[model samples]
Target: METKIFAKDQIDEAVALLREGELVAFPTETVYGLGAIATKEESVKNVYKAKGRPSDNPLIVTVSDEKMVERYAKSVPDRAKKLIKHFWPGPLTILLFVKEGSLPTAVTGGLKTVAFRCPDDKLTHDLIAKLGYPIVGPSANTSTKPSPTTAQHVYHDLRGKIAGIIDGGETRVGLESTIVDLSVETPIVLRPGEITPEEISEVLGEEVLINTGKVSDKEIPKAPGMKYRHYAPSAPVVVVDDVNDFAKIDFNDHIGVMALEDELDKIDLPKANKFNLGRNLVDADHNLFSGLRYFDDKKDITQIYVQGFNEGQASLAYMNRLNKAAGGHHF
Candidate 1:
């Protein structure tokens, strides 16, 4: 099925579908979001069904600005406000307590709070402004699948499932937004994305707590994509402790190596697929999924090997996605 492209001219129709409790994939700086009206429980369920996402994993609502966030959430912490001033309209999402029954319970997964962000794109901003309602939006992909960076990726993952897709070309960040929970006095990093925790601290003057372990089955989360196995591919991928460690392992022919510039030239394996993630982590972050998609597409690749980076601001988000994709397949 051919995917419909909705530009600014056709935004009215998109808004109409949303108002009618229909699903639509729209652009954001981080990625395309498959959205449904947050107040409409039945409509919000369609987002989960369309992407095959789990009901327990809550959805983030996309708004126009901080003022709009106030409508759904009860209070925005001072730290949250500071962070918003620094990263709003970008790849950062703040989690706060919701007004009692302000939004549908489905949007919060029966939790007391919700995640909200004011998108940066002109089309998205205008759509949110015109709709006058919050939209439950998660990355436009199936559960455990790589997040879509381009409109084609969205169509590839959710073409017939959604009513429409706004093709705003490729996303700028090429990753999901940085999710921080401010419901407590101190902020916690529920999910790392393009924005770093250090950057958040610099703006708020407080340390950020990052959640790494899997959440318990009984526990509830305020933000979306918190505990899911995200950005995974069909092929089995592994992340080694380092490039030198990868050299110790031997595979006959169906192996691929993804690495940085320092390790790229050092490792020499014959007739094996190899991808250089660039000299630094920034380029690696941008190209990581594209490289995985390329390798996953190849019929000959049985397993892909990766080299892990040191823990730091530049490597945090990139490593988070890589580690999830690897799932302890590392050598």
Candidate 2:
């Protein structure tokens, strides 16, 4: 029930805690993850409870390397193998045909497929490798809130609810891993991240479909950040095609606008507190979640207006997070 930062030298103790079925919030290259040994159902349950996540909302398991993939996945198709060869130990997560009894039901959410990634973080890889099993760790934050990119965010949301955090400092990508579904014949990208669809297609030497359609009510979430309002801050975010139009509105609550660097001069909201997203789309991706959380901390701001970025191969992940946070609404 106690919460504190664990130094790098303490990974062995963290591994011991995981092996004993306790949850440990740790860093990954993409984001901080609340981890537990994939084989332990009770451990996975604690993870779900800590994040206030639904049991049916599956968890992505982290492995040390591609060699450990087969231990959890039943069939790694040619496409998956090519993807692993190209993007493993990085930000890509591939959903595969889960090996029978390879993982507990809690990890897979009763689905026949399982999503797994080999993170680029040394501490995370060492923890997984030392434990001798895959560890199921989703973003270490409360469900539907901004996904924590730093250990401080984890400590804020999950301090007294679970175990200690292994502060590996800030995550590099600052977004969750790109998730691809390989269970079917043609791979479909379930969630966009740093690894774009074009990159995946180039790696496999074939076109991969990007599933950008609306998720229906009856559909189950194949990955995290889907099937829920996610990456949201305490303030409600509204996406607008142009920030100039927002100048026309008169609202009672304090207004906050996230303005793109190039278009900052065009925005005419005199009273709005503006946050700049750099001209480079990559920088926008880097600052997206943290920017949202920044606005959330502005106590008087109830409505946050975000300048929408056109979704493309490079900007897919940034747009995806914004779309979910605003429920795909464009004002």
User: TM-scores for all candidates?
Assistant: 0.92, 0.93
Record all residue pairs in model 2 with backbone atoms less than 3 Å apart, i.e. clashing.
Answer: none
Worst 10 residues of 1 by lDDT: 264-273
Q: Where is the poorest 10-residue window by lDDT in model 2? A: 263-272
lDDT of 2 by residue, 71-188 (tens): 7888777888888888878999999989999899999888899998999999988888898998887988899888888888898899898677999988888888899988877888
Q: After superposition, how far is residue 102 of candidate 2 from its true place, in Å?
A: 1.3
- Runs in model 1 deviating more than 4 A are 1-3, 261-272
Counting only residues 3 or more apart in sequence or on different chains, how many pairs clash (N, Cα, C under 3 Å) in candidate 2?
A: 0
Q: Report the lDDT tens digits of candidate 1 across residue range 1-331.
A: 3447687679898999899888889998877899888889999988889899888888898988888888878887777788888888888988888989888877888888888888789888888789998788798887788888788888888877888888788777777788988887667888898888888888888888887767777777567765667777788888887667866877556788788877867766553488877787777787787677667667888888877878686777877888889876667
Clashes of 1: 0
